[model samples]
Target: MTLDAPHAASRPTTSDELRAIALEQFASVGFAGTSLQQIADAAGFSKSSVLYHFASKEALLQDVITPAIDQLEVMLDRFAGASDPAKGRARFVDDFIDFLLRYRLEVHTFINQGQSLRGIPVIDRAGRLIVRLSETLCDETASTEDRLRLGIALGGAAYTLVAGATFFEDEIAPADEIRTALLTVVTELLAPVTVATGPRTDRNQKA
Candidate 1:
């Protein structure tokens, strides 16, 4: 949930600070509700300075979320190459938990505001990426139950992290603890169920 510590006290550049502030505002207040001036004020920079770094509010949003989207693309690419479904499922769960934790605010912003911001190129691309992820994770051959399981596992994890942060506030467990718990639950949810291969015996049938 928290960013890694900087090497030095002042290593973060102005742009980096601006993007972080924008991300928090975008997540806390819906994108439609947040203004460039607000971000400028929060970052202690003039509105003109904010504009100098990012052309517009939309551009600033793009700067804030683009890295998360790019990393998602990489995760999808690696998942595609995985030949073992069981292993791949485990790996994907781990990767997804890390992704959600790393980009918690970004995920929160998009999940809550994506529909309203749909026309933006990056938002549209994010939507498509989500669809592709669903498809890649749950293939056509998977049953409805399987698809539902995939949906619940992934969607539940995202919602839990994003919403739980606010819902629990200070009472929430540490990020490492939450990550481990999510990995365990989601991995189990996606795990393949074992079925008996023996001939069926109906209770209604005569022996």
Candidate 2:
């Protein structure tokens, strides 16, 4: 998704131009792989000009991903206040789908390359949010096996969406239809088990 144009002022600041360029570069090569000079060149400014606006590449990355991280925190807070757990989970998924799609590049960076930035506040907050989401899927009372399943389901959905975004870009179905289909699968995956299953017998022993 296209980010909004820089705020209308007499002219856009060098900082704004650098941020836009850094975001694009970060999305392409990730934080560890990008450099200040590359960002400056991309923005048609010298390294000193870029440094005037930001101290270092880390600072640039923090600014790049901060907005997306804050929005996610807000969604988590909103869903936390809900009375129904199931509905809340569904709402979180819908919001998350949109968030992922909108910030796919950032999501891709964090998921695939965030190890380089571990312990950073924003990355840590995102980690905690993911853990909380798994808890939300299956509370402490859930059996270990059930919790494992929920965790895998949640992780799989995220990886699939971020990794397969390109394939879905040229879709045959409408956006809503694709979203509904994914949500249905995730909801079913998280459904509580009501009946125990018996051990399977050999096919040769079947009645």
Candidate 3:
């Protein structure tokens, strides 16, 4: 899924153009498998021209996923300071789904890149976002068991998004309904527990 080359005397390739082509290549062939030559060919530019804008393949990848990661961080910050927790939660769910869809290939790029970006600031930011989200799913009163469950639920949500993308090539947006269903499940799981009957056991005590 590469774009056609610009006609003769067309403007020189912009950084944005290189990034876009690199993103498509990385998402398609994976970061490890993609090469600068591929990106240059796809964008109809010399390899050195691609290098002119980006220092290396890793730098280009960092640019590719940085926007999505930045958006995630902004969403987390907004939700953290939101005045109405209920509305915030609902809105965050909707926006998060939107982000996942808008950056479907970008998300795939990051996932397929594996640990190549390890220790990078982008990865740190993403990790912090996940932790914040896990804490958001629980509260000060939430038990350790409850927190663990919340983490599992969030992981399940990510897995479902990737799986849905793999299964439905032409219908990425429609697959968000899967997240909506998973959100319902998360709400139920995060709700406060109530003991309905009988004496509480040792397991319950620990929980």
Candidate 4:
């Protein structure tokens, strides 16, 4: 992996270059294991120069995480704007599939190496962005209970699709197919529907 550089050897400066370097290092090496020096070196910059732009490695990860989160919000917001639940549900899976494919390393970092992710404290916001997205969409249509249940069921689809890849790729065979199937199920779960009565549990338990 290379370290981030100030500019690409006379090339114009842009966010893309730095972000590319970060993604490269992150993908080749786990986020927890990757260092600012490596990213800077990869981008052809000094370590301090990289720190000047990003402040720290954690900040760099935030830069990476921000896009996935933003993309998710935009998908949900656009779906809500579309005013079609079916389209919204399909969009949800499509968006999540892209996010999972693009950020395989980061997803692993989040699910497997949260402690090293620096700042924003994982426990507080592991799924906060998606949760907020769910609330926003649900408040519009799904009943409170259905929202809670479906959001969980569908969100599990996204997380499990990614996680199942890492944990079961060999056993699953043609992991991409499994991921697609997972996304399909997730999309179906997201569609507005009548849920049957189910068991209830105490709300006080902190998950």
TM-score, per-candidate, Cα-based: 0.81, 0.69, 0.65, 0.55
Give the per-residue lDDT of model 2 (tens digit) for 23-114.
Answer: 77886677777899999988899999989889988788888788887887788787888898778877877787677667766666665566
- Winner on TM-score between 1 and 4 is 1
Among the numbered candidates, top TM-score falls to 1
Q: Whole-model lDDT, candidate 3?
A: 0.70
lDDT (tens digit, per residue) of candidate 3 on 51-143:
998999878888888899888888888888889988887777768767766776676655444457566666556666666777775656666
Error of 1 at 63 (Å): 0.7
Task: Show pairs that collide, candidate 2.
Answer: none
On a 0 to 100 scale, what is the lDDT of residue 14 in model 4?
A: 46
Model 3 lDDT, residue 5, Cα: 40
Tens-digit lDDT string for candidate 4 (1-207):
346453556675545677777865765576767888888878888887887778887677777666665665677667678677767657776876676666655554454445555365532355665567677556554555668666565445435544564667644546687667767766666565654345544599776
lDDT of 2: 0.72
Best by lDDT: 1
- Show where candidate 3 strays beyond 4 Å: 1-13, 111-116, 139-166, 169-207
lDDT of each: 0.81, 0.72, 0.70, 0.63
Q: In model 4, how large is the Cα lDDT of residue 99?
A: 68
